[model samples]
Target chain A: MRRENTRIFEKETTGSFMNKEFIAINALLTVEQAILYLRENVRDKRNIYYVYIINEHDRLIGALSIRELLSKDSNRLVSEVKVSKIIFFKTDIDQEEAVKVFRDTDLVSIPVVNENGKLIGVVHVEDILDVMQQEATEDFHRMAPVSQKLDGGLIESTIGALYRKRIVWLIILVFINVFSGAGIAHFQDVIEANIALVFFLPLLVDSGGNAGSQSSTLVIRAMATGDIHLKDWFRMFTKEVVLSMAMGFTMALAVSAVGLMRGGVTIAIVVSITMVCIVVVGSLVGMSLPFIFRRLKLDPATASAPLITSICDITGVLIYFGIANKLLNL
Target chain B: MRRENTRIFEKETTGSFMNKEFIAINALLTVEQAILYLRENVRDKRNIYYVYIINEHDRLIGALSIRELLSKDSNRLVSEVKVSKIIFFKTDIDQEEAVKVFRDTDLVSIPVVNENGKLIGVVHVEDILDVMQQEATEDFHRMAPVSQKLDGGLIESTIGALYRKRIVWLIILVFINVFSGAGIAHFQDVIEANIALVFFLPLLVDSGGNAGSQSSTLVIRAMATGDIHLKDWFRMFTKEVVLSMAMGFTMALAVSAVGLMRGGVTIAIVVSITMVCIVVVGSLVGMSLPFIFRRLKLDPATASAPLITSICDITGVLIYFGIANKLLNL
Candidate 1:
């Protein structure tokens, strides 16, 4: 049976990629036939990295690199000098996981195997790098909240694809802004009376959004890397609370100083007090929302910087007006 | 010199855990000394995985793993067998980049270095993970447009802090909303005449913001990983365009079907065309903004999902109204 297989192997090599093809040698092949066949027919023997020794059923038993083969006695059978122990990837495994393994092991290439343990293909390190780059790009895009498949293609083609992915979300956010507009218009009397409030309003919202974004980015990134597990919600919440307090106090002192410098006592008090309250609430909300999304088994990234910022925009307005109504007798 | 170092090392490990002072090791010792010290004196070597092999000047020369010692020939000289290949992090390197390397390598610990190659401190992978988790949470909060720090303590103590972070941004966004309101108010005559248009406004803005966020996320993530360099701006922009077109057309078709179901033919045509154009533009803007920020050496993450979304919200409204004004002949 092994002899018959060797005869078939010789016939198949006649049509394959001459420099890249592998020649399977049965353990029974005489040393003379193996050397002659390699020397005469295989013109690119130097390029062939390994000569696999196989069993009668075509199972890989051992391998010999070309250098190893030449170092041995020329008369020795290929199987006599073969080295054991091979690492390979199974076909059923995920490509992403396979890429990770490729990176971790620093293997030049990995052999692919079918479910039955038969050799299928080879995954090169270069290919894994390409995959990693593509996946990282896709993750970044996903974080942005656009959806699209990533693949190798022309720049023009990719841009056209990107445009389609982005537009729908923009429309939704725009319309959402109308609600925010309604929130503002509802407070028209407040704005008219405290026109100074209008001046600080943009600064407040932009800062609040920035702060909230900082929290969400941190949380989402943590969740992505598996550093903070779902079970650590309480611990995370506790940590966020403490961090927010320190941050809020520090920011309030700064903002209050700025307000005092620019807007006098009443405005300073109002801005400082409001600044402290809004930042604390925003930080907690930003940190917790991603956890909530993750608990729901949704993509935590969907609880993104922009979504949180918009939510804060609406909430900040309500809080500002509510606080002002009580404190400033509005 | 080695004998003198060994005599000094023997004098340092003499106390119990409760009474023991943690004396920092300043110089590299032999593998036998490392093993003996760790085995008898160091109670919690779980956190410190390797012994740093340093030169006399405290320059990191190599590392010796405890596990490697356990498996290797125990009688061999430490210098002869210690692994010389060392991967380390410089102190001035950005924490973000450090986190990525930590995640990718999955090392138990990494040595930190200064500009002159002097050893600073060992950044245990666990500590890096802690920092990463905290940062991620903070980013999440900032993304929400909140201004406070959110990770370090109890919620009760931090509530005030949360308020500070959240309120300022909310106030600013509230005022910013006025501009959006003004935009809508400018078109009040148009909206009142076509009340149906008002109903679709929210959906459009939301979709546009979402689309923009998707693009921003992808671009930002690509930037983070060093996959998309500043030089690849043209490629990134072109890809965004292609992706946007494909996504925009698909969404337009879907929205058109919805419009036809709700409104008459004119409304359907207006909404569909507006949807495609707004989404396409939103995606392009979202994709490009991060790269622009990166070019400016500003953090691409600062452009964020919420910032992009909010900006897209305003743009989407303008586009929707502009298209409606022209197409509806209002």
Candidate 2:
């Protein structure tokens, strides 16, 4: 299955799926002659949406749709019948980029060219549809809760295989959580003095984790859709900062009443302030980590939910207790 | 944009994007006559890959490719040339289902018919590709960490609008974490007696949250890709139970060593047992949630990562304390 994963990856080149049987006619041929040639020579005839017009050097100069060919004068040369404004992909380009081209162009078929600008193969729209589906599946898999390994197909994976895939992330999270433990250990005296502080631990930390996850997922998704580029990082970060502030203010107001009921005024103040700080910091960290990854040329999706949570777990504990220690004077 | 969303939704009907300019001819028409009619009447000549043969009642009976029409004897009737086994969709059917049909059959254009089997429209392959991209985007948005409101497009949304979308989930989570607080409160006496127990609280609960998140995501993705169905619930649950047991046992062994160093053998035993139980229960709960949502006709994706984490948090705390109280004589 692992080898199969490699095979799939290798097979993603544009040349691998390109249709070699595509109609390529000499530009000098008449529309009548081109149609006659297509009628005689178009084998592997499924999804033949367009005919490529090639010059004397066999370089693709233009493309003619069946409609355009049929609508034109029968004696017109293929170059006269063809549309010169066409998009083409090199054979070595990734299939994902090819799918993007198909989507952006809204064309039914695109020609695949070699380095010399000669038409080598054609990628049909149906192939692009398959590529789109595969890309979506990969994104979903990559963004999984703990991000299991990409061992061939996801759903059909064996139990042991799936366990092996998921446990790696969990183990990393567990180790990262040791820092969370250390933070708790450092604040033990305060916790011993005010045991009620322990009651709000999960609330404060999990909220931060949730907040961070929301911000990171938004950034990652925006990146995935090409809506947010590296150039937009500053704007994205600024937006997150403002959004988190508004969110934090709202949350502080909402949770302060509960905090008051749980403890005294000092505890309420401690918790409220900690909540605001955690929310703001969580969102900023979430928004920033992806940009850092992108800067390093790593996948931004690698900054996953659990990864964000583990990070926030450690920082969230530090913030809560640091605030409590000062405000409660424990 | 809200109106645009509605328009897109309304446009998902099979008839919405269907091309009415499809070439349909009587079976008695010769290939020459069919081609002549197509040249004269086929207004949308861009993607004319197939020609349909219909009976006198306008019921679609067969289909022929352009290659077949061009290569065949010009004197032959359309019926003699067309393939009889054709797949078609009803006009009112959702476009998602039509996309599925395109994927499964790998057909370029599918005819949309009325209830009486009369051809009404033809759905082009290009439209299906567009639908696939849109559907993928919608799924990603729906399964977001804290799903934003469908105000318009997701990434293009305003900061305030995105904050409004996200805060609902956080506020609800805060309320839910209050249950977690109550769980911790219920076990306050035990925690005060054994402060070591407090150190392991995040570790145990977060492990469960992580495990639960993994299960729910896998199930949700499987459901999205059409790999899992309602009937597979029993099998899916059984698989999860076995997988979680393997996962739990492995995690228990690894963490028990750390537990022994933190506490004593009794505390270690308690934490280890609780870890195993929580892992199993967490995974089972996560696996069950999406199925339950699906059974209720709600989106299975609504059982989101944070929602699963919150659910596991309360239950995980209870389980850890429940086990610790009995074993450590708290």
Candidate 3:
């Protein structure tokens, strides 16, 4: 709201926020003349943090701040002082990715280059901040088990729009959850013989779901921030396997205490062993699904909590029942 | 990584990122003297976007940029060209809040003020970007059913650390899920009489959990972004009631079709009616818990997916079996 006057930054395209009237002096211009040119020609100079240097082709050669330029000898050519170490984004780069570059490089402003590497515009750090916030809000929305349309800011959406966005997912999840019912049905005899087995149904499957949800959410967020890559699949998988096993072991020990009280030794052994297996399976499924989605060129966040939970439901049921049948002699 | 040499910015304290070396000129200093002072004293001027103007008492009065000073007449007093419209943060402000201010105001750098409104330092946008990314990662970690320590950057955390962080949540959730088992246990006679009724347990309860997860995730994210404040509770609650009812009706219709094929007309009627009630209950519970947490001065993100799912599972089972008992005259 403080930036009401800076509505240009809110535009979807980066070009709208570009300062076309920027001071891009020829590399040969002396610092004093470059200062004179900036004073005489540049208007709307609210965010002129740096002065760009270009060659005959108007391709960006280097950049220097006004402070840097003023600190140096006014008699020297700008080419003599400008730092050639530059980080820039292409004109067509996503604004979110542009913000990442700025954050990674810690630049006050980044030059925009065309396909020919000709300098066209500059993206100020302030503008990139806005884009980053918007992208973050969108990512949160996408990661929820709701429609993509709700990815827009909640305050900006109408009630009708919110309903429309959320209903589709609930409907799809309802249909998908049918498999969970069928999975339970296939193991009906096991439950019919030992009704106590039914009591652990939500507990067993939910453990898997919870473990899976944790993995997918972490993996998705790390992937988004470029903290993890597709190439790190081996490391990621290995780490998840070891971590989940430890996690599963801890959870099994905790829950087996409860199982010992309620269902005796046979039930305790079945539930404890199943806990370890389900958690490992859940974590592996959750952790790997995002990588698979990325490899398939899909948005990794589409592997949401509910989707992961629903998938875990089937696998969890099969594993829990299979172990119970073998151990409990169902 | 570009800011590796600028190790201070990565600090948890905003004061660390403050540029105490900033050009704070007196109101009467001529633009020439201001520029000369900057040239003589400043070092490591990588992000000197603004020049703070202070009084004799060293209290900040206004700000002027180097570009503004250079473009002005050399003899003009700094105060004559400086703008008093300034935005700033306090030294003790949360880093996430500082990032929000940067995004909202679109400032290249924000001054850090002391208790007496004296400018102590400046927070460059680049530093704010790092804080923002960390906060985003933390939010993702909190929303999951994992431990907070795992919120640390994926690449930086050890496997043992990740396991420790995540195991706490999974173990707690397993204990919480025991109530879902109890809820199912209470309805054992109804299930034994009708084996088909047992089939929809995962479907019915998971639908509730999924719907609840969606609502909680959206509310938590909106709260984090400052889009939905605690003051907006009445409006948020009213909107959620309508939206969830709509979602519930849609899900009920979809699932009842499956129920009819699997369990005949009575089961269809019971499951369909239960679907609507469970969804509405789940959504309302999920939507309001975050508000309640905020009102209690707690982190709204404490209403995590696994926590909500465990809560919903108990209620979802009661609703489904309660409806079946009454409708089927069991």
Candidate 4:
């Protein structure tokens, strides 16, 4: 249900990932009978871990791992040999959820059931491994916003594909950078009045962006790994705010000396305050954007470092100049 | 061997990850005898897929899946049922290599052997899944330079730990930004004459960092997944140059219009040339830092997004000012 809203996951449900070949034995067969039946039928099925059991209507009944089945009394009925609690997936569960399931149960494969509880197919750990890698890589790309996956390795990918993959985001970021330019432009008077203010521009702004990048990275990965949920946003935000304040003070203490050496006490004050405010604002935006994207049913990694940095650059400019404009009293 | 150089991986070799409990049947047993042995001993053992076959010396000789074993004739010797070639790991192989081996072989668990080929223990698919997630997350943190992972997620991590994790990088970045400050300080006269240059500074510098971030992320993730290697460096660098030039032109085209609107034809030319040059420099630096780190027996992921951006920002400042100073003749 949670995955239905995300477009990338819609098609890869457990129904689509079933192993075509699996042994589904009847519930009536004794261990001895099933072994005899399977010896004739189960030739060369690649790594069969679990053999499913079915009742008269062919509905799912129980399950037995080959390991358990082998270590049982041959005269015991399939009912006596099978596992009591079957862990299974409905046809609609996404591969990500399937990966989570396999992790919990330690079963290499699980049965997938249809609407009427009939076993349609089995999903294996091999597929789960692939999904784990795919989901992680997809999220990696989005966080990097490498934007699209290069199906092959980087060396194997065509130059055009590389160019196309990277250019759009760079261009979009240039557009976003316009606001930073505009923020600087709006404070032309303050900038001209104290040209020394210009010295700390990149230093201060880049710190904000860097802090924001860290915040977004933390929140995005936490969400991706299911370590934190959507309901945890407010708690996360509060933690980020407190975390950023302590970080801002540390950065301010380090940056103030540079500000003082460049432009004296007033300039140091402006840069330090701007540093604190920008770090807080930048970090808050960085941490919050991913949560917003997830709520919109989008990949939270869409709040990439470049995207976060570009945005923080805008806020960084405004905060720096806004602080400078007031303090300089021009 | 690829892992011995990196300190983080040295402790996590397959020797450290071997499962404590596994079934190792002797090569001399008949199928019926082994079954009777297992039936008594294997109750409640979780997800036993492969019962490895060993020789008189306890050396790994072959492996038999329980599924395959059951389908054999009861009177057949274990030699008749066990696979001819076994898939296993040396006790010293790293977990990442273990992960790759599991991916290539469909077995849920692979046995580990000592230098003498004596059976030590088995490694399971469950652990592979954990490593897959952990490796991806570690590289993700390194790329994000989240610096260190918050083991219990963001909400549970202390403000002090969060501050400590994020602050060092931000402080180091502040020092790196000094080059940008010095570059601007060196060009103070040029700015006094043509102050419009300051408006384009954040926008232009960020584009370089953004482009660099993309390039580094590509190389880093590609390396993590084994899609590319250290040997591909020269070829990748050449491709990056070509890729950067094309991207530079595209960005130059986009940024020049704003350049023209703001500061006339002369400023536009300076901005365009600087844009092209900065992207190329940023792209080259980002592409190579990882390779350099790898060669030094460190994590290539140490070439992080924030690190790339800070270095790019420094180069961005110098290049943009050098071009503007020559062209403006101030």
Give the TM-score ranking, best first. Answer: 4, 3, 2, 1
User: What residue runs in model 4 are displaced by over 4 Å at the alpha carbon?
Assistant: A1-10, B1-10
Encode model 2's per-residue lDDT on B1-330: one tens digit a residue: 123223332457886777665778899899889877766765456577778899998889998877667777779888888899989887677877887788777578888777688877788887887778777766665555665435455457888788777898899899999999999989888899888888888888999999998888878877876888999888888888899999899889878988898888988898889989999999999889999999999989898678899999999999999888787784
DockQ, Cα level, model 1: 0.13
Write model 3 residue lDDT over A25-77, tens digit each, in one string.
89999988988888776546667878889999988999988778777788999
**Segments in model 1 whose C-alpha atoms lie over 4 Å from true places:** A1-330, B1-46, B69-77, B104-106, B113-120, B151-154, B188-193, B261-263
Prediction 2 global C-alpha lDDT: 0.81
DockQ of each: 0.13, 0.55, 0.66, 0.68
Writing each residue's lDDT as its tens digit, candidate 4 over A1-330 gives 234223232378988777667888999999989877776788788868788899988788998887677767889999877885899888789788888787777788888777788877788898888888778777777655576777676888889999888888889889889888888989998899899998899998888888888888888888877888899989988888888888888889998999899999999999999999999998999999999999999988888788888888888888899889888995
Ranking by DockQ: 4, 3, 2, 1
CA lDDT, every model vs. true structure:
0.58, 0.81, 0.82, 0.84
TM-score of each: 0.54, 0.92, 0.93, 0.94
Give i-RMS (Å) per prediction. 11.1, 2.2, 1.7, 1.4
lDDT of 4 by residue, B1-330 (tens): 223223232467887766756788998999988877766767777758777888899888998887677767889999778897877888779888888888777889988777788787778899898888888778777666677766666678888888878787788889988878998999999998888899899989988888888888888878877888889999999999999999999999999999899888988899999999999999999999989998998888888788888899988998999988898994
Off by over 4 Å in 2: A1-9, A146-156, B1-11, B19-21, B41-45, B55-59, B116-118, B148-155
Candidate 3 runs further than 4 Å off: A1-21, B1-13, B150-152
Candidate that would win on TM-score: 4
Of 3 and 4, which scores higher on TM-score? Answer: 4
List per-candidate RMSD values in Å. 13.3, 4.1, 4.2, 4.3
Interface RMSD of 1: 11.1
